[model samples]
Target: MKIKQLGERALIQRIAGLLSGGSDIVVGAGDDDCAVLDTGGDDHLLVTTDMLHRKTDFPEQMTARQIGWMSVAVNLSDLASKGASPIGIVMAMGIPPDTEVEFIEEVVKGMDECASRYGTHIIGGDTDAHDELTIVGTALGKVKKGHLIRRSGARVGDLVCVTGHPGTAGAALFALDKKIPVSQDILKALFEPVPRIYEGMALAGTGSVTSMMDISDGLALSLHDMSMAGSVGFRIYESRLPVLPDVKRLLKKQELHEAAVFTGGDFELLFTVAPDKIEKARKACPLTVIGEAVEKGVFIERAGRVEELKARGYEHFRQQGQ
Candidate 1:
């Protein structure tokens, strides 16, 4: 079957099935945010990579610096979800021949600033000529073995939580599409997302967090991912979601709810915490309890009616409106 018909997630599962994993590989492909490797030390090594293209990933409104920052931010977000402290980043860029040198310089500067903000640096990278501006970044990180969090440890009664406000990025995208005037703060949510590295580490240290992942692909899709990983279901309440005030004003109630649920690119942390340890988790990081884990089925309760939360987000390679 064609890849589009198979879908991105299924294709990943197929690819993962063909690969072989070793003993030192704590976490392998298609399972979690980063691949964990036991380095025979107190900490495990975390590795993740992400690819972004100009047309698909970078919006036209983004500056050269934002593009560079996003390239590294996406990779770091993955490491953050695993409670890993970033060591360094290696970036590979595919640039068009006609691109200006100054623009490339700004891109590099942005990458450097972002990495440095998170206490890391761009150690090495490669560049090549391509038809479009393409960037691929690989981030390396380490986390104490006892403090490491993954997407599979969620238990059936754990509380579902998320950090920061949801739907801000989606709202920003909506505003940009509609040509509505929006503040730079809202626009920055999409242009320069802040990876929750500090919060992730704090949560990991609390030992209250059960499962964790970054919400780059919208809350619905991320929750579905956690559900699959932990073999549990989630029933989140719409009223409990912490949405930005700007988003509420930008869209009507229905639109706001939909944006919060389905829109992607937030890059916030979505995690589950043990019920008894909820206070500890809260003390470690600012989070809102949106729901609780259930035995089976992912559903959302809105207006007193519960509906299935569809697994849909910013999927690549699949045709739109499929």
Candidate 2:
């Protein structure tokens, strides 16, 4: 069968099925955000990588600096979900031979600035000639063995929480597509997403969070992912969702809901906390309790009615209209 027919997630699962891990591997392929390795230290090693293409990942309006920032941000988001502190980053750039040297310099500068902002640095990387501008970033992180969080530890009756506002990035994309005027803040949400590094570490330290992952693939799809990982269900209330004023103002009710649930690029953390320990989680980070874990089936409550939450979001190797 064609790869497009299999879709991204299925293709990943197929490839993961062929892989095997050594005893040192704590979390292996297709399981969590990062590969956790027990390196015989006080902390576990975290590793994650993400690739961005000029045509599909980067918007035309983004500057070279923003592109660089985004490339690193995406990988860091994965580290954040694991409640790990970043150690360093390595990026590989695939660029056209005709690209300007100054543009590349600015890109590296952006990468450096983003890394430094999160208490890390870009140690080294490689560059090669390619038709399209492609950047692949690999980030290394560390978390204490007892403090590491995964997507598979959530339990029934746990409170579902999310950090920061959702849909802002999606709304920014919508605004850009329609050529609607929006503030730079809204646009920045898409161009330069801030990984919740501090919040993740704090939540992990609190010992209240049960499971966690970044919402890079939209809220609904993320819920589905966590559900499958933990073997638990989620029932989130629509009214409890934290909607950005800009998003609400920009789109109608239906579009607003769609942007909030189904659109991606937010890069916020979606996690579950023990209901009784929620105060500790709240003190650790600014989060909104929008729902709770259930026995089975992911559903969203809207207007006092419940419906199945479809696993739909930004996915690679799939047609937009599909």
Candidate 3:
């Protein structure tokens, strides 16, 4: 009866069933961060919001500025996956009354810097007092009618590809927990992640991307999501996984591989394209082809064998043991 027993995904399904979508709504909840809405124009409007709590999201090593940047970056990443041009961002903060004004100013500075980097600005928001620190950001963006990418367009035989690599953020988290030494690059990967905005837009312009989504939930879960949305399956080769060479050397083989598949926090784009259009897609955007879509269930091929892919990535309620 409670959320803990059902898990985040199940709870979302229940909530989605109760919600009614209007004709103006292009894409609603249950897929990505933003809900696409059509306003009888050549372009569709995208609305998305993301919230981060201090207890769960903020790391001890992160400063107020880093937290602020992350709060905005996460939402922008969602818009990027839709190949949308950001309109603006509105941020709401729930800060403790005792918090220093300087700290809050630094947070705003961080948000402004990150927004400027993406060619967007923070328009307005509300502030409130709370027992703990909470930051919420709502972003608005727009995508041309036919250019908007979704998670459901992937077809069988489509080539699955990803922008950049994975495992750096995951490995950083591991090192932080274990008190292991890590390079500045690794810390940067975890503290300040770069969203694939230009890459997503380029891929969308090529008209070759089928299903597209940000791999914030890890590669294995992201593939599962694409598979379910497209009503197809996927078979990714382990040898084809993209990971930084430094990470591979620092972590054990199994550890790095597991992080590549199971770690969340990476904001890279994972998308698919038709086999015939793979060359065009690659020309438009640099990405590594890791696999292809199949007819049925999701799988991964490794060491000359194949196995069913499991969703072992982050789950909110499950992770909290709620």
Candidate 4:
């Protein structure tokens, strides 16, 4: 099969499968990112690495600073989902030797802005020469005892909620690709995503929230992960999903159902809270109740018919490339 047909995610899975691993791993080689042991006293460390290839992650017209900012933000966002505070960052950078020094400087500038904004420091990093540009970010975070929310703690009867709106980023991507006109506001929102640090901090000590994850790949797939990780089913009400107008304008062939249900890049938080604490959660922070956890299998209510929720989001090792 062609390389594109196999997709980058698939290629990674295939490569990952070919290797054998050792025992230093607390959590290894899967999920939104990876976590390794710190061996420090009384604290569980979270280590996540994200690599952004220039062509894959950003357009040619995008700014280097924004690219750096997003790279750090994406990793920090993962830490927030698990209720961790970022501590330090290390980077492995590769770029064509001919690349402008100013571009490289801007990237570092953006990374510094994001790091300082979140109070995380870039302690160490490396640079290498390559034919194409790539940035690999490794972030370390710490979570207090009993505060780290896993993908496996969701229980039946827990209410499922998400922070902020969905589908805007995906919509923006489609609009740009199709040469469709989108408002400047949406374009900016799409190019630059805000990680939900406030909502994440609020979830601390929230006894109601059982399981949590960031909606990185897509809400549908993220929800699917919670179901599998927690061993519970999910019942999502599509009617309750929040969507931006920019997304609605781009839904030409697919109905609103498809756009809101499967599109990714929203970067919001997907979490499960207990029924009793729903009101308390609302008072404490902003969220939308899109569904509840069930006993088995995923179900979605749409068009007045309740049917099984299919796998509609991107999968790393799926049949073929996107």
Candidate 5:
């Protein structure tokens, strides 16, 4: 069997279980991108690490600058989802000794772009020469006492809304996989992932949304994670899902709804709020009402039928063999 068959969570528990953590670690491994811990006083510190390799995370055709910039943007996307501001970044870069200095500079320049945009600084990290290129980043952010959004806050009868559309990134990936050169529109959506900094802040400022998370690992996985964490059920409307024209074409080609929701790496935000207060939230942020929270299990409304939802989003090193 292949690891992809096991889904994303099973794979996370499989590997994350092997690692150990310090006592002060409030949270480690699992759930919404990264783990969080209580920083001494009024702040909560978030730490997350993600890797980029040619075969797994990036394609060889991608430039050094695109690679480095995406690395920072993705992690910062995680931070933005939590409604936190970044403070520092530390990198663990693995490069072949033969790698050019000019290429490295491009990667750093990408990082710099995002860092300046979000007001975070890449403080320090380590380097190692490896057979393949690998870039890893661990970021630090401080969430104010009451503003940190977690997956566990969702409640039954809450309205499910998403920031931006759900399928652009997936559409972008599809284009890359088939070597389908993208149209100007698709290329921008796929390459430039906009972290929901403004949207998150607006949602956080409203003081109404019960729960929130970025749609990094696709909509299904993010929704599933929030449901499990909040111990509530979600009923997502398939027809109501905002899919880009490009993504719909991609889904039609695959003949699978899973292609739209199961594949990950789109860094939009998924969140829930009380149905009664949904109007207020709508006024506060630019989000689409995709679904709602339910009682027991995750459900999806497709065509006209409503059924339980069972699928995980993308992961590189989850399940290797069946």
Candidate 6:
């Protein structure tokens, strides 16, 4: 059977099952946004890594600078979801020998700019020669004891919330794929995403956030993740979903809904909070209450009816075969 038959998440679970860790590991694989390590101090260490490839990840419209910025931004998003502060990042680049030196310089400059914006820096990294341009970035951060948020802590009746807007990156990609003209703002949203670092920290500080995860794989897939991790279900409201004006105007309602559910690269955070703590979350961060956690099955209410939410998003291995 082909690898796609197993899918990306399944393959990751298979690999995670083979790995073992000691007591120093606070959280293991397939559990949270980032791996937690006990530092033998008041603060715990958080680590996450992300990779970007030219042919598969980067779009033709994005420049070298945007690509480099994105390489760091994605990893930082993981740290943000965990309520960790910026420590530093190390990057490794695989480049084609034919690439110009100026191109590399611009990419590095972009990486530096993004890291500085988020109060972090790229201390060091390694480079290797390859046929395609590939960037791998590892981000390190710290969170206080008893303050780390996990995806497994969500409880029944917790309000499902999301920061800023969802489906912008997905809408941008949809325009690109269709050869349609898009605004610069939309392109920027897709090419250079801003990780919600401050918002995440603020929400975590409120002590009301239960389960949280970054929405890199689309809203539907993210909800599924939280559901699986917490062993609970979600009931998302269609009326509460924050759809952008451009998306609503450009695509039909059905197309827009599909894009919001299945489009990836948005980098927003999906979190849960108890009903009593909803006011705390609202004051601490800018978020919209999209739904609530249920007792059993995941469903979405639209037009006064509810239905099962199918998991359909950007799966690397699954897309290869399609």
- Tens digit of per-residue lDDT, candidate 4, span 96-165: 9999999999999988888888878889999999888899999998776567777878888999999888
Cα TM-score per model: 0.98, 0.99, 0.97, 0.88, 0.88, 0.97
lDDT of 2 at 228: 95
Clash pairs (backbone) in predicted model 6: none
- 1-322, model 5: which lDDT tens digit per residue? 6775666677888777888987766667875555888767987788777777766777565677778778888888888778778889988788899989898888888887877777888899889989988889888887876887877888778898887777776767767777876666655555666777667767777777888887777677777788778999888888877777766765564434655566666778888888888878888777788888888788887879987777467655465221
Q: Which digits, one per residue and each the tens of the lDDT, describe model 6 over residues 1-322?
A: 7887989888888888999977999988866789999979899999999888999999988888998899999999999999888899999999999999999998999899899999999999999999999999999999887778888889999999998778788788888999998778777888999998888888888999999989988888889988999999999998898988877887778877877777778889999999999999999888999999999778889899998988878777786213
Model 6 TM-score, 2 decimals: 0.97
Task: Report the lDDT of model 6 for residue 152.
Answer: 81
lDDT agreement of model 5 with the native:
0.76
lDDT per residue as tens, model 1, 1-322:
8888888888999999999999999999998999999999899999999999999988899999999999999999999898889999999999999999999999999999999999999999999999999999999999999998999889999999999999999899888889989889999999999999999999999999999999898899899999999999999999999998878989888778767988888989999998999999989989999999999889999999999989877777787324
Q: Where does model 6 exceed 4 Å of error?
A: 320-322
Off by over 4 Å in 1: 320-322
Q: Who wins the lDDT comparison?
A: 2
Q: In model 3, what are the clashing residue pairs, if there are any?
A: none
Query: Tens-digit lDDT track for model 2 on 203-264?
Result: 99999999999998899989999999999999999999998887789988888888889888
- Candidate 2, residue 271: the lDDT equals 98
lDDT of 3 by residue, 1-322 (tens): 8777888778988888889889898888876657999998699999999888888887889988888888899999999898888999999999999999999999999899889999899999999999999999999999999999998888889999998888888889888988999998988877888877788788889999998988887888888877778899999998998888888987898788777888777888989999999998989877999999999888888898998988778777776312
What overall lDDT goes with each candidate model? Answer: 0.93, 0.93, 0.87, 0.77, 0.76, 0.88
* Model 3 lDDT on a 0 to 1 scale: 0.87
Off by over 4 Å in 5: 1-8, 11-26, 249-256, 318-322
